[model samples]
Target: MTNEASLGRVLEELGTTLLDVVCGDAKRSGDVGGVVIYDPLDEPELPANALVLGVGLHDPADLARVVTQLGAYGAAALVVRAPVAPDEELAAAARESGVAVLAFARGASWTHLAGMLRSLTADSGPDDAHTLGRIRSGDLFAVANSIAALLDAPVTIEDRNSRLVAFSSRQEATDPSRVQTILGRQVPEQYTRILEERGVFQAIYRSERPVFVAPLPVSDDAAQPPLPRTAIAVRAGDEILGTIWVIVPEPMSEERSQALYEAAQLVAMHMVWQRADADMERQLRAELVSTALQSGPGSLEAVRRLGLRDEPAVVLALTVVESAAEHALPAQLAAERKRLADAFAMHLTAAHPRAAAALIGDVAYGILPLLQEERAVLVATEFLARVGSRLRPLVGVGQLARDSSALARSRSGAERALRVLRSGSVSRQVALLDDVHVDALLIELADLVPRGDIPSGAVARIVAYDRENQTSLIETLRAWLDHFGDVAEASAAMYVHPNTFRYRLRRAAEVGRVDLKDADARLAAMLQLRLMKITDPGF
Candidate 1:
């Protein structure tokens, strides 16, 4: 395991940019366990020595109360919005509880702060998690800060797609556009459009040297003119990995330009290292998730390593329906599956920081740390809707598992629910096991019966008659049963006249020697028809 980061290290990295100490000695607070957001109405369980974000808690009394509570939980620090005026009671509470108090900068975002802290605190193997030259390898925040220090200007690192990766301190000193980028974590679309129209991005990507851009004119009445920017693309061989951009007043001198070019090389190295580390960690997590789901001899240890030992969670099994890519090449399907799995992992993390997801085989499994099955259903539905119908995504949410030991059972339930969906018994994309219990039971029954032989009884006779005479008797009977013996609905479903449907239904009953009026007889026919439909769609 990698060495845990101390609260002092967190302050050392972020203090110059985002945080201000209010009370307690951070250096003495030791290592922080993880970052957690404080929820007032429903407090989530905190890991030991957590760094808690006290969002929306402004009152001194409330702050003091939270500080005391966090201390009881052995939290390292409680960060509230600045500028905090620590009263005597609050100071006393902090002192008594031995919990350090910190203030989040006024303009900085809680989301960004949480993300930065998580990056610093997330677990990793020792080999890839260590520092290089006083800064953690692959730590974009530290790289951006170092670049800003060298350039004496605000900095923002962006991926090739123009998505913000990390930013330096003193963003408030930059233009309104920069502030907007920091707040949204993305360059505004209008700004990107203007750059694209001006061939600014093309120029930056095409050149290895620093490219200087003039200030953008005000695009709207309320918009401020953006400051001039100097950008250099970070490339690995022929591949452009990302760009490093600095807010500058003018084109740089030759020496500083050389420094910026050198910095791009460093940034490229970090980006590539981060990508490799991410792949390794993803594989490691996949193995742990697989082991935990098996509930085998190593399951307990795996669950502990995953930090989900005692947590109540729901298992969500997500897979692409065959109809979405039935004719696609195997490589294309594999790529799509991996893409969906990555997106699912990100979505789950955004939903709950403690949640874990991984792609196992063709299906992506997410362990959503939620208390309610209904909430899991809602989350799954929202995810499928957001992912759209391109893959025709399907998610099966299992019942809530109250602890780690129950996860295997929950996974089994989710798999059963997924099977029901894949068998085309249900029309909806997202389902809970409880919602489709009957269909799942029917699938289980089909599995129990032998696969080769035709189903027996009234449905078997109907199938044989259809095969022998090319009759519509099986279709007619299935439609009637599906419509619960409604002649009008059944006929409409089969696209035949009600009189014709009635005639076919009577002939089916006669050929099978069945009594339609008998409830037991009708029930038997319905069961057999369902089993056959599930086992053999052509029947």
Candidate 2:
């Protein structure tokens, strides 16, 4: 609550240049106050504060006189530090006088204002050398860290399941605990509210709302109320990749919080950059992948890099699964990994040597970033069928994407397609988007049936009963894995008591003597069970 007159006197001495001050009270009073610059009654300079009243003219004539005097004196703009006068009257008077009036809360005396100011003025982007080039996995990780740096706080990024994926921190450079991976674990519900409210991972569950949580108090020898914290949730469109939660031990200044919000947006950009390349591959195919993977001016500034506009394209993704543990040993495993990678690359090269292909790992993949059709099904069937015939590992294809940058989505589609193939019912084949129509087709592969296979009366009756009971033998067989065969994963999926499953499975094994572990046998049994069940619609 310093006076404009005394403040004016100090300004004459300190020579504070380019500072602007406004009267908050005048605006609401309806009486315009006189404005004065540098030496109130003297010269007006570029850095002088011009005092303008927020209210109307006390002397309507003097009001005009003061405004005329002030402008000739030099006022950059009128600012209300805190308006005491009524806004409507003051605004009307200011408008009548053709004077611009702006309002600002006299910033509170924040003890950490210097640090906060530095945060505001500091360069948010990395130095020129550190500017982002092409988006690489490592580069994307770095980008996440850079965003965390801007936040000046430890932030953990979680997926929809609340599994922590990435954490950002510049404060703890070498701390292993800060970067701990929590991807496969469930987050406590209490700690998950921030993300839930932001709809970060909520949509995956088909609903979302903002939620708040108390700052998790740190255990220490001292006792006091801990600082407050906030979190912002994030989702990849409707797909819940998870939430990006910001933890502040104490409430953040409005500026700091706003700065953090901006940083959150930047994190989203990095996610898009990192995942966009892969997404484009599934939808945009080669041209997108080609344009993305092909080297050029890597930074965002390189405008002429690739003028890729949206165009029709088909997307296919291939996964090369290499055993990491097997490849990490001290001995021949490293060499073996290299060999396998080379083989995958060569194999894929032979498949569509001209298609956009890159050796990602044990799996070689293609972006085919550029193509001219949305029909990936027919294209994949013709291309992958031939490749599957020759390749040892499998591949999958997804629907085409109109936007080239979303190619990564194809990887998910391809992964699902491979799962279908791994069911051991079909040989190498393309899984087009339309394959969803093949619920019947997937159950009907001839390869699944034994040559001239026949079911005995008892087995047939049981199969009939299973269908009549509305139980999916296909799912049950998959769940039991050939009556808990030594090679089956029955324990993992069904959480079943193996002995009981074994009894039912033994009965089923007797029906067809189905060797569930054999690829062909599992396929045949699954197909027969599916047919018997589906035909018996009542089941």
Candidate 3:
């Protein structure tokens, strides 16, 4: 009639007078879920919850070896026939291995006892069905909290990456690891390392059933029991979404363990729903970004829906330029690009909740909301750091657009900055539109200039003379104008004597058919030469 049975309950049902505890007296409260008869002739595959070893072997050494194997298999407790006196070797092995050791009374029927224990510990049909029903009702937190209350322990739900998603409210009895993990919402790297070293994560990934991990050895005191932990992978079909971690002070009762299993199923369902919702949200955001870039009539409305109304925002473009050696298969490259895009969106949203990001072609674009213009560079710097060195992306920050209507202009600026970076005009990791605006303007202007509109007269004649004679007349003219007609400075710049520089200048005026005495003509010639440098392809 009991919902579940423990080692003590099993022994009591068999009659306390029938068994003697030689060691592991402290672990009498351990739960007994199943019975396994040890056979030395065959390989033993022990279940994690509990194992009641029947007395088929009489040697003390063999009993010690079985106990060691059971402990290594994470068996809660082992039951065996009593010895004439306490076996010191068996006791020592049990203590060292942290496996509970129990002895039945001498001459007790092993077959009768194993049958009785198995029946007593059989799964509670109604209790399990009710627990599963509650789990399937879509209330994972409520079910998890109820389980915690039943077991008198704290519980944490984590994603496959070991990031904490939810945890029980019970914190009256907790460890540093629990506290830190809850505070950070993820397992710290150092604690993750410890778990990795203990093979706990590997076991979780490998096992279909619940995995039991011994408490971490944070303290060296043998008298203090380590914190016992249990994990069940949250799986939907073959895909594991996350895990359910239970911190147990004692072995879990069968009913509670069943509830944990059901909880994992519920967690998996919740994760599937959450991921679907996130995907929808991401798709919508990407559409919004794309629409804004297209400058559609609905773009302003979309921007407002994202919570950026009158607020100023900047467009940041991240161009992925992978090295030839880093090329991957098409499938792998696509997946990597998708991951990077997701990373960009997540980081941008974290920085500014209203920010929107999308991967458009090979570039990831983000419309980042900002309160002030001064923070643009700082935001760009932080973004680059977040991207890290792995991608080696070229980041371009556009000028801040004051309203949603100007978002397209901001995006254009970002694109122009990216183009400038690719053109080798700027050699930095991040290029801001404001920094490259002059070059961008000049480049645009140069493209717009008609071929016939190129400077003629004085500047054209000097260029023609330099090409025909293979002379430095144009160079002399540029140096003289750069020094504001300072003869001494111009001569020093050209590494020539002042008298020689003056002679070259006079020759330049003669070849160009310009009167050097007229200041207006001289200024006009300087302007012509500057425009030719930008607009003329030959220059």
Candidate 4:
């Protein structure tokens, strides 16, 4: 095995626990091959996987700046001793830069700490060698067992989200926290909240060392005493994958802590491997969804591959407004869009198991089985409700497709409805294609209408007369047609006297040279004017 130590082991040996983890808790699994004492005047010559800096860094701002620079140099972690506690700004910068921030106790010996770290880096134990070899052989269980045996403690491995991935087999020695985490496959939200208030997670994220958390007071009437725990971050480079937590009654010995740190490195390797496999699966699913959206010969085959071939389906589209996109950075916006898409897909899958959702560009598209048309509306409404006021996204639902062939048509209809929703005429969060059929139909036929085909002269003459005289002839005619040519109702709608409406109608007829007495002519005029509003850019 390689003779290397982690920052966590070094800190434990130096008798200093983590103060606050600004960022890079996941990266604490990295090996520490050397140590560097930082001098501000001189340029840093950091070695690979080197732990840098030491106590006597008094100013938080200056310390934060140095931490940032060390992060850029790819340092494993920053060791500092402050006269006063570091401020939040320093912690925030360290987090953003993915550098682990470790603060020693007040009046701690920097020289002794540095010398101890150097000596530790020069030694490697037989058990450590065995664990590292097992990790490389893809035996994560062996690594976990080794750490549990060495520390004589029950251990649990959890992903960054606190979801349990692996655990030691020492069930009898496990505490309530380990049992709860294993049973739920995640840390309980109540426990998570308590830890957050205590800054445990903050320390975990920023520290490249093991963080010891004391038991918290129980709120329940039959409250049980909390167990003490030692947790180390599992990381690959600057990317944190998970954490290895040991439930112990007291602090671990230096030898045991060092072994635990080595085990974390192995766990990080395992996590990286698992993530790579997951990424591959995600990419394949994205490709399948992309293929299903097309109308080519093999599109139905693609749908079959995703196991949604025979189900009645509809397409749903969600789009973020330009204003929201403008306010966020490109990277932040992209990440948000991805998060929304994943959330939508998860909800869709939960409701409709055969459904598929994907984010293509700024829009999120879903092809879900039409179990019930109302359910589609419910799903869309629920998604909007969950999003609430944060995104203010517009949603459009297409008509149901009875078969795969019509899937493309459903997608087209959804796009059409989305266009109408984007026009700002609808006040609701979701618009269905059926609800906007008239506008959709007019938009579809607008391109097919030939120039000067029918009633163009009458429409042009009426429009010119209204524009030149500042009158409302077109509005009156539209209202009359809408009310089925009811003169009294049209007059009421226009807020005009009956005789004034009649006079305007007559003038409209005279100016356009149209015979309003003919039902065919009246119907034609109404269709033309309505189509004009939809198709004409100036209108």
- Cand. 4 Cα-lDDT: 0.70
Q: Provide the lDDT at 400 for model 4.
A: 87
Give the per-residue lDDT digits (tens) of candidate 1, residues 437-459.
99999989888988765468777
Better of 2 and 3 by TM-score: 3
Candidate 4 lDDT over 446-528, as tens digits, reads 66888655338787789888989999887877777888879899999999998999888888889888898888888779878
* Model 2 residue 351 lDDT score: 28
Model 1, 438: alpha-carbon shift in Å?
Answer: 2.7
Lowest lDDT block of 10, candidate 3 = 130-139
**What TM-score goes with each of the models?**
0.78, 0.28, 0.52, 0.53
- The TM-score measured for candidate 4 stands at 0.53
Residue ranges of candidate 2 with Cα displaced over 4 Å: 1-139, 170-212, 216-228, 235-242, 281-539
Write model 2 residue lDDT over 139-244, tens digit each, in one string: 3334445555666765666555665445444322322222222211235564456545655343424433323335443457534443344555554565444556
Please state every model's RMSD to the true fold in angstroms.
5.0, 26.8, 22.2, 21.2
TM-score of 1: 0.78
Name the runs in model 1 displaced over 4 angstroms: 1-29, 37-43, 53-68, 76-114, 124-130, 310-314, 320-356, 367-393, 399-406, 427-429, 444-457, 460-476, 483-504, 518-520, 532-539
lDDT of the candidates, in the order given: 0.83, 0.42, 0.69, 0.70
- Using lDDT as the measure, the top candidate is 1
